[model samples]
Target chain A: MTADAAVVVENAEKWFGLNPALANVSLRVHPGEFVALLGRNGAGKSTLLRVVARLVKPNRGRVRIWGVDVARDPERGRERIGLVAHQTYLYPGLTARENLRLHARLHRLEGAGERVAAALTEAGLNLSADRPVRGFSRGMQQRLAIARATLHGPELVLLDEPFTGLDLEAAELLSERLRQWAAAGRTIVMATHNLEQGLEGVTRWVLLDRGRIVTEWTGDSTAVRSRYRQFLKGAPPGAQGRRT
Target chain B: MKGLQKHLGLVALLAMMAALYAIFVLAPVELTMGVVQKIFYFHVSSAWVGFLAIYLVCFCSLRFLRNRDRQWDIRAAAAAEVGAVFLTLNLVSGPIWAKPVWGIWWTWDARLTTTFVLWLIYMGYLMLRRLVDSPEQRARLSAVVSIFGAVNALVVYMANRWWRTQHPQPVIAGGEDSGLHPDMLLALLVTVLAFTLLFFCLWKMGCDLERTRDSVESLRRTAQRHLREVR
Candidate 1:
C-alpha cells in the first residue's frame, strides 16, 4: 500500500441473499486523485461508495480507509471519509449555520463555530449562512452541501451526482472547487452521468456496463474516449453475461 | 443490546401472565366492580408501555436530528411502531374495561379524547414515510414529526389534569383515584416490566426486517445491472 492510496478494497462482494450487487470489486484511490465512477443506472456506483463509507457492509471483502478496517472501527473510519449526493442532506427548516453546526456537533469538532464560518465563506455561502436553507435556490443549496462535506475536512470525498441540477456556471464553479479540493491532496471519487463533466479533473477512469467493470484506463483521454464509446455500444448486448 | 432484545418481549409476556394470574388468584374482588377489575392490570400495563415507547421514540428522534446517524432513525421507527401497537391496545381495552365498570362502551372524557388524537398523529407519521421519495428525506421528515408527536404525548398525559372532566371520580388515593393494594400494586409492577420487554422484542424484530428489506432492494439493483450488461 502506498502513502497516497487513500482507499483500498480487496475482493469486495456485496449481495442481497442470492443476488450479488458487487462482485470481486477491487479498486485503489490514491491521494489527490479525482476519479469518476461511470456506470448506467443500477450499475453499483452508489453501492460501491456506500460500502467504502461504511454505510453498508460487504459480504466478502475488506475495505481499508487510510489503512483502517471500516468494520473494526466505523467511527474512526468515517472520520476520513465524506459523502455528498443529489439530496442536500440538510434540514430545510434550519438556517445554513444551524444545519452545519449540527453536523459539527456530531463530528465532535472543537471550535465548530469558527470552522463553520470559514467553510461557509470558502463555499461562497457567507451571505446565506443565517438564512434558512429552504429559502435558497438549487445552486445555492448545492453550494451549502459542498460546504457541509468539507467542514470536517475528510481525507477522501465521495460525491454522487454533484452536478445533477446545476446551471452551466454553477457546474463550472463547483468543478473548480472539486479541482481545488483534490489539489490539496484529498482523494475524490465522483459518480456522474455527464460524461463531459466526468471527464474533467479525472486522470483515471473505470467504465461500468453493468455491475462489473468492463474496462479501466489510467491516462490518455483519446484512448479512454475511444474505449468508452466501444463499451457503450458493445456493453448493453453482453451486459447480462458479464454480471457474475 | 442482544440481551435487551432477547428479554424484551419475553419479560412483557411473562409479567402480563403473572399479573393476570395474580388478579384472578390472589387479589380479592373489588367492592365496586367485583371480578371485572381484572381488566385494570392489562389496561394500565398497555398504557404504561405505550406512553413509554412514544417517549423513547421522541428522545431517540431528537438525538437522530442532532446526529445524522440513520441508525437512530431506525430506532425511532421501531419505537413508533411499537408505541402505536400498545397505544391501540391502551385505547381499545379502556373502552372494554369501561363498559363493565362504568356502564358505557365509549366516553367523551378528556383523557380518552386526547389519547385518540395522539393515535391519529402517529398514524399520520406512518403515512408520511410512504409519501416520501428518499431515505434521507424520510429520516429528516420523520424526526420532525416525532418531536411534534412527543410534545402531543405530554399534552395527552396532562389532559385530565389540565381540565376537569365528566368522567367518574377516582376510587384510589392518587389524584382522581386511591392507590392500589399491596398485592395489586406488585402485580401491576410485574405487568409493566413484562410489557416493556415485549415492546423491545417487537421493536428489534421490526428493525431487523427493515434492514433486510433494504439489503434485498440493493441486491435487486445489482442483479438488474448484471442483466443490463448481458443484454
Candidate 2:
C-alpha cells in the first residue's frame, strides 16, 4: 500500500436520462487495498466502478487511475486497469484461447500464448481453455473471466460479484487467491451482494444506497464483521442496487 | 443554423433546379428523341450522387474499423442512408426514361441489373447497422460490409460494360466518350455540382444530430438510475 493511491475520484456525477446514477461521489484507494463496495440493487456501485474502468464516461467528475485521468486519456490509463462484470465481455463464439489472445493483443503483450496458457492454468481451466466460451458452465466461465481480467497483470482489478454462482469450495479457493493478489501489492475493488463472503480480507468497507455513499468504514476483522451485520439488518430486503 | 449555413443546402438545391429547368425547358429538344431526352438531366445526376455517397461510405467505414472512431461510423451511416435515397431515384428515373425511349419499362439488361444489385447491397448494409447494438461492433461489422459493397459496386459497374450491356451505356461508346454538346454538358456538370453540395449539407446535419442523440441517451440512462435510487 506504500506505492501510491491506485484510484482517486472527486465530485463525480452521472445521469441516465432524468435520473442521476451517481451524484458527487468520491473516494480514494491506495495500492493493494482490497475494498468491497456494498450496496442494494440500485446503488451506484457498478456505475462508479465502470466510470473508473473507463468503460463509461461520467457526466461531471474527475477519476484518475495511477494518477492518469481516465476520461481525458482512457487508453493510456486503461492499460493499468482490469474489469470483470455481469456480462462475460468475452466473445461467445471464440475459443477461450482465441478470446484471451485477442485481449492480450489489445494489451500489447508480447508473449501472449505462454501468458494465456499460464492464466488458464491459474484459473483451474487449462482443459477447457481451447473450448468456445458458449459451452462453459457458469462457474467455469467466471473462472475464465478472472483469467482474462488478469491476463496482463493489471494493477487495479475491478470485479462485479465475482462469487455470484460459485460453490463454497470454489469461493474459498478464489478468496484465498484474491488475498494473495492483495498481498502481492495489487489493488482489488469488488462489488458484491454476499456480504459474508466479500468481507474476508477486505481492507475497507463502503456502503452505497440509491447511488450515494451512505457510509464508509475501515477496521480489523472483528469490527468489519459487526458493522457488516448491522448494515445488512438495517437495510431493505433485496439485492443491492447497481449503479449504471 | 445561421443564415448562410441554414440556406446553404437550399441554395444548392435551387442551383441544381435552375440547371435542370434550363436543360429540360429552355434548351432545344434533342433532335433524336424530342422532349424525351429531358429525363437524362435528373437521371444522371442522381446516379452520380448515389455512386459518390456509397464510395464515401466505404472509405469512412474502413477508417472507422481501423481507428474505432465514432465519428466515422456516423459518417458511414449518413452516407448509406442518403445514398439509398439517391439510388432509389436513379433506379426509378432510369425506368421512366426507358419506358418511352425503348418502349419497355423493365429489362434484365446488364447495366440495369448491376444497378439493381448495388441497390440491394446498400440496403442490406443499412439493415445490418440497425441490427447491431454496440457502436464499436457496428463500426467493425459495417466496415467489412461496406468494403464488400464497394467491391460489388465496382464489379457491377465493370461487369455491365464487359458483358453485352443490354441497357444503353451513356458515358463511353465505341471505346470513346462521346463528347456531349457544350450546353448539355454544362447543364449536366452544374446539376452534379449542385447535388454534391446538397449531399454535403444534409450529411453534416445528420451526423450532428446523431452525436447529440447518443450523448443524450447515455445521460438519460444515468439519470434514470439516479431517480430510482433516490426513490
Candidate 3:
C-alpha cells in the first residue's frame, strides 16, 4: 500500500467498553480493487467498512479515503465515498423519484432532474419511481439504494451485504455492474456472506475472525469457495466477543 | 478539558453551595413580595441557563451542518436535552412563584406564553430525535429543528420588553433606574454563575454518555443486520 491507494486504514482499532470490536485492522486498497470481506456473523467486517466510510470513528487509528484523512476532515473524504449499509437510508415518506431528487439536492449535483431520471432507469424502478419508497419491495428498495449510493459518481463504493433480499436475476445484474465498475477503476469494498454471489466481481478475498484479519487470498472463484466452506465448517457458533 | 473545563464539576459544586447561602441568607426579603421572592433567584437563573443551552444548540448545530462532524451533533443533542430540562424548571418555577405574587396560578401573557411555547419546541426537538432511526438523518433533522428553536428563544427573552405583559421587566439590563437591590443583584449573579457552571458539568457528562450510547447502538444495529443477512 502506498500514498496513492484509494483507501488506507492504518492500525485501526475500535473498542466497545471493555470488549474489543476491532483490533489492529490495517488494510490498503489500490484504485479499482474489489475486495470482498468474508467472515462469520460477528467478525467485524461491517465495522471495518463503517470505519472506512467515516460512519464510525475508530478508537485508535487513521483512515484516509482517496488521500483525505477521515478523522481530520471526514466531510471532504465522504464526497468520494458511496456507502450502502443494511439500512436503505431512504425516507419512506418520499416517493422513489423524490428520494433521488432529495439526494441530488443534498449533494448539489448539477442537472438534478436528469440525474434522478437516469438513476430511476438504472435501478429498474422507472415504473414505480413516482410511488412511495415504503411501498416498494425489498429488492426494489435495495436497487434504488444502490443507484442512490452511486448517484454522485463517488470514487469508492462500500457495500455491506448488498445481495440481501435480491432475486437471482437482480443479484446477477448487480454483480455485472460491480464487474463494470471494477473495470472502469472505481474502488469497492463489499462485506457479504453470500460467498457465491460476492465472488463474481472480487479481485481479492480477505477473511476476518474475532475482529482480526485472519488471512487473504487471490485465486479462482471455485478454489476460494472451497476454502470458505472449509473455514466455516471448522468454526464454532456465537463465538466472537464484544460486551458493550 | 485543557483549561477551565477540567475542573468544571468541582467548581460548580462549590458555586452551588455559595449560591445557596447567598439566596437564603445574604439577600434580604423584599417588603413587597415577602419570602417567596426568593424563588426569583432560581427562576431567572434557570431562564438564563436555558437561553445559553438553546443558543449552544444553534451554534453547535450550525457547526455540525458545516463540518458534518458527529461530535458537533452530539454536542447539539446534549445542549437540547439540558436546555429542555432547565426550560421545564423555568416553566414550573414561574407558575409556583406566580401563584403567590400575582394571586393566580397562570396567565396567558406574552412572556409566559412565549416561554411555554419554547418548552414545547424543545419537546418536539427531543421527540424528533427519537423518531429517526438513521444517525446521520437524525443529526441533520435535529440540527434544523434546533436552528429554528433558537428564534423562539430570542422571542421568549424579549417578550417582556416587546409586548409589555404581566411578567416583570428585566431588572439586570432594563435601564439605569430598573436595577435590583444591591444584595439581591449579587445573589442573582451568584446563582446564575452556579447554574451556568452546573449546566456545563451536566453537558459534559451528557456528551460522554451520548458517545457511549451511540457506539453501542451502532454496534448493535450492525450486529442485528448481520444476523439477518445470515438468516
Candidate 4:
C-alpha cells in the first residue's frame, strides 16, 4: 500500500473447495519493475496474477494497486490495471480495429479512434486491422490482445501466460514491446512457464512453488535459467511440470 | 455445520410431506374444478420459487459485475439452473391442469405465454454459458443475460394485467372479493414455504457440484501437466 508501490498483495490466500490455489502469498512491485513470475504448472502463477488484477479475490488478505485497496475500491483498481490473460478477450466477429475501438471506448480513452489506430500500428496489425479477428492466426490474435491490454495506457500491466501460443518471432516482438513499456516507467508482473523467454528484459525474477515464492533473483538474467532448472529439480515431483 | 445441513434437509422433506397432506386431505375440493384444482397448490408454489430464483440470479449477477468475484458468478449460474428446473415444472404442470380444467392441453394466454418466454430466455442463458470456453467471458456474457431475464420476469408477472387472457386472476392480489378461502390460502402458504425451502436445498447442492467440478478440472489439468513432464 505504499505510495510508490504499483502493486501490493498482502498475505493473500485463495482456495477452491478443498484445493488451495494460493496460500499466504505476498509480493510488491514498484514503478518500472518488470517482474517475470516463473513456476511449473499449477504453482499458482495465474492465480497470483489474477489476484493482482482483482479479477479473483483472495479468501483472506488484501491487494492494492497504485496505493488503492482493490477490495475496498475495485473500480479504481481496475482502471489502473491492464491484464492479458490466457484468452485474447477479443470478439472474434469484430475486426481488429473494431475490437481495439471497443476497448478504447470502454476505457474512456481520449481520441479513441486515433489511439486505436496507433495501437494497431504499434502491434504491427495495421494491415489486417479491417479483417475479422476470427480469420487471424494465433500469433496475430496474440499481438492484438497485447495491443488491447495496453490501449488504455494503464500504469500496471499483468500478463498471464501471454506466450502460450506464440511463435518465436511473435514472442520476440512482444518481449520488445514489454521492454519499451517498462522503459516508460510502467510496472509489469508477468506469469510464464517459459524459463528462457521469461528472462529476457526482465529486471527481476521470482519462482513460485506450491503457492509460495521459493526463490528470487535480481540484476542479471545470465544464470536465471540454470538456477530455475535446479530449483525445479529440487521441487516435489508433483510440482515440477508444464501446463497442459 | 454438516449436522445442521443434514437436519435441515430432513426437516424440509418432512415439511413438504405435511404440506402435501394438507393440500390433498385438509383443503376442501373446489366446487368448479374438483380434483384437478389440487395442482394449483404446488404449481403456483413452484412458479413463485422459480421467479424468486431468477431474481436471485439477477442480484448475484449485479454483485459479480461490481466485484468481479467468481463466487457471485457461481451463485448466479446455480440460481439460474435451479430456476430453470422449477420453471419447467411450472410450465409442465400448467399444461396438465389446463388439460383437465380448460379441456385443452395448452393456450397462449398472457401469463402462460410470458412465463414460457422467460423460460426460453434462461435456457438460452445456460446455452450461452456452455458455448463460451473462457471462464471470464462466460461469466460476463451470462451476467448480462441474467439481468435482461430479470427485467423480463417483471413483464411476465404483469402480463395478465396488461393484456386479456384466459388465465385466472391473481388469487392473493385479486382485490377485496377475489381472495382465496381461508383453508385454501393456508394450504397454498404451506406449499409455498415448503417449495422455498426445497429451492434453497437444490441451489446449495448445485453450487457444491459446480465447485467440485471446477476442482476436478484443475486436478485433471495438473495431472496432464505431470504426464507431459514425464515424457
Candidate 5:
C-alpha cells in the first residue's frame, strides 16, 4: 500500500515567521495522476510544490515520495522526484548534452552517454545538443530544463511555472510532452497560473487560496475558471469546500 | 538549551575577570619588553581562537556538504566571521607590540604575510555569500571556499616554524623548558581559556543572528507575495 501511492502529504504546515505558507494541508496523489495546482499569485501554489519536492521543509507533518519519508531520508526521496522550477537548475556554461551528462554522472546512472543522447533526441534538441544553454532561446532552455530534470526517470515530477516565457509553438510542444508523460503513467504535478493552456491531459485541478486547498475538480477545464471566480468572491480566509 | 545559552554569557564574563587579574596582578612584567609585553597574552590567545575558528569552519563545511543540512552552513559562516574579528585583534596587537621592541610598526615577514592572506580568504568567503542570492547556491560555494581556507590556515600556522623570519620563535613548544616564570605561564594559559570561551560566546551570537536573518528574509518574501496578490 505504501509503495502504490506516488506522493502523500499529511497535515503538512509550513510557516515563514508569523506568516503561514501551508496550513494543515493533506493530499494524496496516486500513480499516473496529473494534478494541476491552480490559484492567483501568493496562493502558495509554488510553496506547496516545493514542499513535495523537499526543497523547503514543512514546519509540521509528513511528506512521503514513493513510500520514502522525506524528513527521514531526503536524498533517497529526492532520487524519486524531479523538480522543474521557473529557473532551470542548469549551468548555462555547459551545452545541452553536457548539462544532461553532468547531472547523470552526479546521480551515478548507468549508460550515461546513451541516456544523454536519448534525452536530447526526446526533447527535440538533438541537432543543437552541443550548443551552450545560454545561447539557446528561452523555450529551448526550458525544454532542456525539463529533460534535465527527468534525466534519471523519476517516478514523480513537480513543475513550477514552466510555461511562463514560452512562445505558442514552444508551449504546444511542452504540452504535447506533458501529455506523453502522463499517458506513459508518470505522476505529474504542475503549478501553473494559466488554467486554460496546459489542462489537456491534466486529470485533476486543485485550486489553492492563501495556502489552503479551497476547491478541487476533475475531468475538464470547461467551467473551472468561472467556478473559481465565484469561489474567490465568497472565499474568506480559512474557508474550505472541496469539489470532486 | 535556553538556560545553557544564558549562563554561558555569565561564565564567559567570570573567565575574562580571572584572566584580567592573572595578567595584571599575578604575572610579573618582562625585563626586556616591559609593560608592552602584557598585550602578548591577549595577542597569542586571539591567534589561538582564530585557529580554532578555522578548524570549525572546515569541519562544519564538510558536514554541510555530507549531510545537506542548512544548520552546518550557518555554523561555518558564524565561525568564519568570529575568526576574522579575532584575527584582526591579533594583527593590530602584533604591530603595537613590535613598534617599541623591534623599532618598527610593521614588517612583511612570513608570519605576517601568511596571516594577512588568511584574513583575505575569510573576507572572500563572506563576500561570496553576499553576492549570491540563492541560499543553496551561496551555501555550496562558501563551503568549497571554506575548505580551501582551512588548508591555507594550516600553512599560516606552520610558516613561522618552517621559515626563518623576523617573527619570534615558539615559546611554549620550544625545547624542554619554556624559559618563563611559572606565574607568567599560568597567566597565559588562563588568558587562552578565557579567550576561547569568549570566542564561543560571540560565535553563538553570530549563528543566532544568521538564523534570525534567514527568518526575516523568508517573512519579507511572504509579505511581498501577499502585497502582489492584493494588488
Candidate 6:
C-alpha cells in the first residue's frame, strides 16, 4: 500500500452465494483522485465501491484504507470513510438536523453542533432542518444523506448511485459539492450509471463489466459517453444485465 | 457433514423420548397435583431454553455491531426466531398448567407478566426487521433492540424474587427450605439437559434454513438479471 493512496483494493473477490459480485478486482486510489465508476447495471460498480468503504467484505482478498487493512481493523478503517449508499441511511422519524447530529455523535465529531449546522447549510437544508425527513422530497432526502456522509470530514468518500432520484437542480448542487470536496484533497469514488454526468470533472473513469475492469480513461468528458456506449455494445449479453 | 448433522438430530429425538418416559413412568407423581404436575418437566425446561436462546440473540447482536458482518446478523435473527417459538410454547403450556391448578387460565402475576412482556419485545424486534428494506439498516436497528430486550430479561428473571404474587415460587432457587427431592431434582436435570440439546438442534436447523433462503434469493436475482439481459 502506498502512503499517499487513500484506498487500495487488491485481488478482491466477493460472491453472494452462486453469483459473483466482484471477481479479482484490484484498484488503488490516491489522495484527491476523483474516480468515476461507470458501467451498466450489475457490472459490480457498487460492489467495488462498497468494498472500499468497508461496508461489505470480500471473499478472498484485502482492502486497505489509508494503509490500514479494513479486515484487520474495521473500526479504524470506518473512521476515515464516509459512504452515501443507494439507501439514504437516514431515520425517517428524525429531522434532517437530528439525523446529522446522530451521525456526528456516531463519528465522535468535535464541535458537533457547529459541524451539523454547517453541513445543513452546505446541503441547502438549513430552512428545513427541523422538519422530519419522512416529509422531505426525494431530492431533499438525498441532499441530507450527502450532508450526513460528509459531516465527519472523512478523508475518503464512497457514493453509490448518488444521483439516482435527484432533479436537475439537486444534481447540480451535488456536483458542486463533489468539486469542492475534490479540491480539498479528499479521495472520492462514485459509482453511477449516468455516464455523461459522472464523467464531468472526474479525474479518471473506469469501466467495469461483469465484475472486472474492462477499460479505463482519463481527461475529456465530451466523447466519453460514446466510448462507454461502444464498450457496452461489445460486451457479452450477460455482462449487460440489469443491476442487482 | 450433513450425515453427521442427521445423526445428531436423531440422537436428540431419541433422548427426548427417553426423557418423556422418565417423566411419566419413572418419576413418582406429586401428591397434590398428580398428572397435571407432569407438564412441569417440559414447561420449566422449555422456559430455560427460551431464555438461553434470547441471550444468544443478544450475544450475536453485539458481535454483529462490533464487526458489521452479515453472518452475525443472520445468527441473531435465527436465535430470536427460535427463542420466540420456545417462548410461545412456554406461554401456552403455562396456561394449560394454570387452568387446573389455579382455576384460572391466566393471572397478572409478576413472573408471568414479565415473561409475556419479554416475548412481546422480541416479537416486536422481529417485526422491526421485516419492516426495514435494507439489510444493513435492519441489522443495526435490530441489534439495538435486542440489546435492550436482553436487559429486560434480567428484570423478568428477578420479578418473582422481588414481588409476591399468585405465581408459585421458583422450585430450584426458592431459598434453603424450598429444595426439591433428590429423585425429582435428578429427573428435572435430565429433562433440562434434553431440552437444551433440542434447542441447539432447532437453532442449527433455523440457521441452515436462513442460509438457504439467502442463497435462493441471490440466485433469483442472478436469474432475473439474465432474463433482463436476454430481453
lDDT of 4 by residue, A145-244 (tens): 9899889999888888987878887788778887788788888889997766655568888888778887789877768877777776664544544433
TM-score of each: 0.56, 0.64, 0.63, 0.69, 0.71, 0.71
For residues B27-126, what per-residue lDDT tens digits would candidate 4 score against the true structure? Answer: 9998777888899988899988888988899999999887667788899999999999999999999989878777888776666777788889889999
Ranked by lDDT, the better of candidates 1 and 6 is 6
What's the C-alpha lDDT at position B139 in model 1?
79
Model 3, B1-231: lDDT tens digits are 567788888999999999999999999998867999898989899988887888899999999877667788889999889988998899989889888877887876666777788888889999999999767778889999999999877767686446754546433223322667898899999999999999999999999999899788778976875665454
Taken over the whole model, the C-alpha lDDT of each candidate is: 0.78, 0.79, 0.84, 0.84, 0.84, 0.82
Residue ranges of candidate 6 with Cα displaced over 4 Å:
A9-25, A42-190, A198-203, A209-214, A234-244, B1-4, B66-71, B165-179
In Å, residue A195's CA in model 5 sits off its true spot by 1.2
TM-score of chain A of 5: 0.92
Q: What is the fnat of model 3 with respect to the true interface contacts? A: 0.00
Report RMSD for candidate 4: 6.2
Candidate 1 lDDT over B57-167, as tens digits, reads 888889876755667777888888888898899898888878886677876566677778888877998888889986767877888998898898787758765564444
DockQ of each: 0.11, 0.05, 0.06, 0.11, 0.07, 0.16
**Chain A TM-score (model 2):** 0.88
lDDT of 6 by residue, A5-72 (tens): 88888899976335577889989888889998988898899889878767777778899888999989
B1-231: candidate 2 lDDT, tens digit per residue: 477677887887788788777787666677755787777877788888888988999999888766556788888998889888888999999888777777778776666787789899888998998899756567678889999999889988788767765556653235212756777777777877777777778887888788888789778876774565545
Per-prediction TM-score, chain A only? 0.90, 0.88, 0.91, 0.92, 0.92, 0.91
What are the fnat scores of the candidates, in the order listed?
Answer: 0.21, 0.00, 0.00, 0.05, 0.00, 0.26
Query: Candidate 1: what lDDT?
Result: 0.78
Candidate 3 clashes between residue pairs 3 or more apart in a chain or in different chains: none
Model 4 / residue B32 / CA error / Å: 3.5
| lDDT, candidate 5, A1-244, per-residue tens | 7677889999888753345778988888999999999888878989898888788878788999888999899989888888877788888898998899989988889999999999999888998999888899988888898899999998788889878877787788778878888999999999998866777888888888878887789876777767766666553453323221
Query: Local error of candidate 1 at B109, Å?
Result: 3.3
Tens digits of per-residue lDDT, candidate 6, B118-146, equal: 88987899999999986767888899999
Every model's TM-score on chain B: 0.87, 0.86, 0.86, 0.88, 0.88, 0.88
Error of 4 at A154 (Å): 7.4
